[model samples]
Target: MILKDCQRAALEHIRQHSAARREVAQETIAHLLEMSNIAQEDFPQALSSIQSHARVALHFHPDRLSQNLTSVADLLLTDGLYKNQFETFLSNGALSPDKGGYRDLWENGMFGEVYMTAHVTPSDRPKYGALNLMLLPDGPSPRFGSCYFLLKPHVLPRCTFSSTGSQLNPPEKGTLDTLDGVLAALLTESFYREFALGVHNIRTRQLIDHLRDNLTKPFQDPSTQAAARNLDYFIEVQVHGPIWLADDVEILVADPSFKRTKTGMLLEKICEGYDIELFWHCGFVLNVEEVPLDFRGPKMPSLARRVASGTFLDVEMIGEAAADLKRHPERWRDRGPYEYVLQELKRLWHVLVKFGKPNNTQK
Candidate 1:
C-alpha cells in the first residue's frame, strides 16, 4: 500500500476504537487527516519528498481535567516546580519561540514553538522529573526542559504536536540524510527507553544479565535481517492518560541524602502532584516506506554530506555505542587542539544520528 493509504487506514482504525475517549481525540485526528491531505498538495514530489517527523500525542488526567475551569496552562502554572519546567524555560529565555510564534493548527488549537534548535532527550535523571531535556546533557546543564504548552481544553486541542529533524546533525538539521535515519532512530529510542524503564522495575543483577544477553545475541535469521534492512516510517499516534512516579523514585526520596539533593527534591515535588495508573489509547503506525527520495544534495548544507554515505547504526549497535560513550567519557572530555575538538564534534554527530536503517541497506 502507498504511504497516504496507510495513514488513512490508521485514522480509520482510531475512529473505530476512540469512542470511549473524550472529544479531544476525534478533533486531533480530524486535524491530522487534514494535514496529511495538505502535505500531498504542498509537496509536488510527494512520493519521494523527505517525510516530516510529526506526531500528535494526547495528554489527559481525570482529576486534572475534571474542573471545567482547570486549564492545562492553569495546572502547569499552579503545579509545584517540576511540572512548571516548560513555563520556566520560556519565561527565563532559556528557550525562545521559533521564528513564527504560534500558528493555528485548527480553529481552536495552535502549534507552538520548536524551543531550542535541538530535539529533546529523556532525562538521564528520571528520578528528577518526567522532563524531556533539550539537547545532550553537556554544557552548563539546562535546568528546565521543553515540552508542549499546556493550553486550556476548551481553547486547546488537548494534544501536543511536534515535528523535528530525523537525523542529519545536531540542533535537528534536516536534509536528505534524515529520510530513513529519522524513522529508525525514533522507534528504536522509544522502545529502548520503555525497556530501560522495565529494568528499573527489575533487580539490578537481573537487568544486567538481560543486557548481557542482548549484547551477545546475533542477528540469526536471514529473513529477519532482510526485513530489518527495508526502511519504514510511521506516526505513533497515542493518547496517554495520568502520570505516575516509579518505585525507585519513592525509595530514593526516603534517603535523607537523596532527599536533600537537587534532583530528589524536584522529583519529590513532582510525585506530590500526581499518583495514578498509566493509561494509553492506541493509535497507529502508518507505513511510509514507499515514499520516494529525489532531493538535490548539492544545494543542502555542508554537514549533510558527512552523513550521506556513512553506515547508519542499528538499534542494538546504538545501545552498545551509547553504553561505550558513558563508560568512557574522558575520550571526548577536556578541550584541546582546534582540530581535535572539531573531530570529536563530528564523531559525536555520527553517534547522535539515532534513526532509520543503515544507509548500505537503503532500497
Candidate 2:
C-alpha cells in the first residue's frame, strides 16, 4: 500500500463528507471497491450514467417508509447501452488488475483494506442479475446496472485539473499533484458519486418511467410479421437525427421495440408522405464529465416540497394526458389519483428535459 501526503489530506476531506451521509457513503465505497478496475480513459461516461441512476434517478421515500436499498436498486436497473458496454469490458478482462502492467489499487493500494470491508452492513444474499448495483453475492437481488473504476490521480497527467474528482483542490492547494493526493481525491469523489447516483436512479426509475410510460402506450399493434422493405428513413434516424411535432423523433422512436421489423414497417408507413430531412450532427459527444451532468440530487432544490409520484402503463397519448391533468386538475377534482399521477409524470418529464439528454441508442 502506498500513501502520499497529498492523498492523506484528500482522504481527510472525504472522511468528513462521508460522516454526514453514512448510507450513501457506504454504498459509494462499495461501488469503489468493486469497480476499482475501470480505466479512466475508456469509460468515464459510466460514472455519469451511474451517478444518473444513483442520485437523481433513484428514490428515497420518507424515512418512515423508505424502501430497502436492494429493492430500490432492483427497481432502478437499466439494461441500456452503458450496461452492455460494462459487461463487455468486464468480460474482456478490461478491468483486470494486471492490464495496466500495474496491479489495481484495490488489490495492492493503501485502500485495499477499505475495499475488502466496503460492504459495511451484513446484508442478505441477493443473486447477481445480468447486471448489478451491488457487485457480488451479497446483495438481496441482482440488478441491471453498476459502476467500475475510472482514472486515479497517480495515473492522472500532471497539472491537469480533473473534474473527475480524482484530483481535488483543497482550500490551501491548487490541486493534488501526487499519487497519494489523487487516491484521497478518488475516495472522496467515489463516496459522493455512489450516493448521488443511487438517489438519482431511484428517482428516475420510480418517478420518470411512470410519466413516460403513462403518457405513452405500449406496442399494441398486432402485426407480428417481419417484412422486408426500404427502411431508409427509419435507418436514417439511426444514421442521423430528427424531430417531429416538437419531440425529438429519436426520443419518440428510441425504444428497441421499434427496431422490430413490423414496428419499423409501421413507422415508415405512418409518415409515408411527410418530407422530413434527417439532421446529421454525429460530432463527438462532449466530455460529459468535464461539463459534469447537473442531475437533480442533494445539490439541487427539491422539485416539489412533496410531489405525489407514481408509474402508469396502458395509457393513450400519455404526453397529452399528462398535460391535461396538470393544466386542469379540477376537471378530475374528484379523481385526485388521476390528477396527481399526471402531474407527477409531467414533473418527471420536466426533470428529464432539463437534466437528461437522450441517448442515440436505447441499448
Candidate 3:
C-alpha cells in the first residue's frame, strides 16, 4: 500500500479499537503525513533531494514509551559526554555542571530538540512532542556529545487544539552545543543513577554487563552506538536505556571518582527537586537505518497524553516492569506512529521507482 494508505489504515485501526484515541492519533499521523507530502513537494525528488543529516520530525507505551524516553535521554546525554575522560575532566573544569539548561517538553514545545515524553496515564493522547526545527549551531559538534541535553520533568503536556496546523515549532534557539558542560553533569548523574538504581534490580543491572561487554573494541557496538561519518562531527545515534550500575558509572561515564567531582555535588541538588522517576525527554533527527517498507508498529495500544504512569514510578516498581515485559514481550514492540510514516514513505517510493518507471535521459 502507499504511505498515505498505510496511515489511513492505522487511523482506521485506532478508530475501531479506541475512539477517544482517534483525535490524537489523527493529529500525529496527519502531521507526519503532511510532513511527508511537504518533503516531496519541497524536494520534488523527495528521497534523493533530502540530505543525509536533514532534520526529520517525529513516540510509544508507558513501559515502552518510558523506555523510549530514557533511551533518548541516554542518546543525548551519552552523545554529549562521548569523548571526555570522566575521571579528572570535571575537576579540570573541562565540563562544569552550571552550563546546560533544561527545556520542559511540557512547556517549550519546539521542533528539533532531542526530547520526547511518554504519557503513562492516558493510553492514547499523543505520543510525539514538537520537534525543535531551529538550527543556529552551538559548536561542540555532534562528535562531542549531547551538549544541550538535560534532565527535566517527565510529565506530558496538556493537549490543546489549534488550527495553526503543524508549523515547525522552533523554540528560542541559540546554541545547543555550548550546554556541553551542563549536559556532562547530568550525564554523569544519569550514569550513577542507573548504577545505584540497578543495584536493587536484576534486569536494570544487567545493562551494566551489556555496557561492559561493549566497552572494549566495539563489542557492545550492536547493543548501542550505531555508526558514524568521515568528519568527527559524524556520530551514530547511540542506543541507551536504564541499566544496572553494578559498578561505578565511571565504567561508561569514564569518571573514576565521580562522586567527589563538582558534577557529583550538582547531581545531588538536581535529584532533590523532582520525583525520582522524573527524566528529561529528548527528540532529534539522526543518521538512522532504512526500516523495512513493511515495518510493523510496536505491539502496544496508543497512550493518552495524561500524567506519567505511577505504575513505574519508583525503583521498587522496576520488578513489576520486568514482569510486564517478560509476560507480554509482543506489546513492548508495538509499531510507533513516527516509524510507520517514515518507513511507509520509503516503501511508497520504492514501489513507484520499481513499477512507475520513467526515462532518465531526457527523452
Task: Give the Cα lDDT of each candidate.
Answer: 0.24, 0.24, 0.23
Q: Point out where model 2 deviates above 4 Å.
A: 1-313, 317-330, 335-363
lDDT of 1 by residue, 1-363 (tens): 122322233233323333334244334433433533433232212212212211121122111121233423344335431222122222211122222332111101211111222332211100112111110111011111111212112211111111231111122111222222222233234334432221223332232234334322321222122111101122211111221222111111111112233423433444455331211111111112311133222211232322232333222222232233334446534444433433333333223221132223312
TM-score of each: 0.21, 0.20, 0.17
What's the true lDDT of residue 314 in model 1? 25
RMSD of each: 19.9, 22.5, 26.2
- Supply the TM-score for candidate 3: 0.17
lDDT of 3 at 345: 26
Worst 10 residues of 3 by lDDT: 299-308
Query: Using alpha carbons, what is the TM-score of model 2?
Result: 0.20
Ranking by TM-score: 1, 2, 3
Order of the predicted models by lDDT, top scorer first: 2, 1, 3
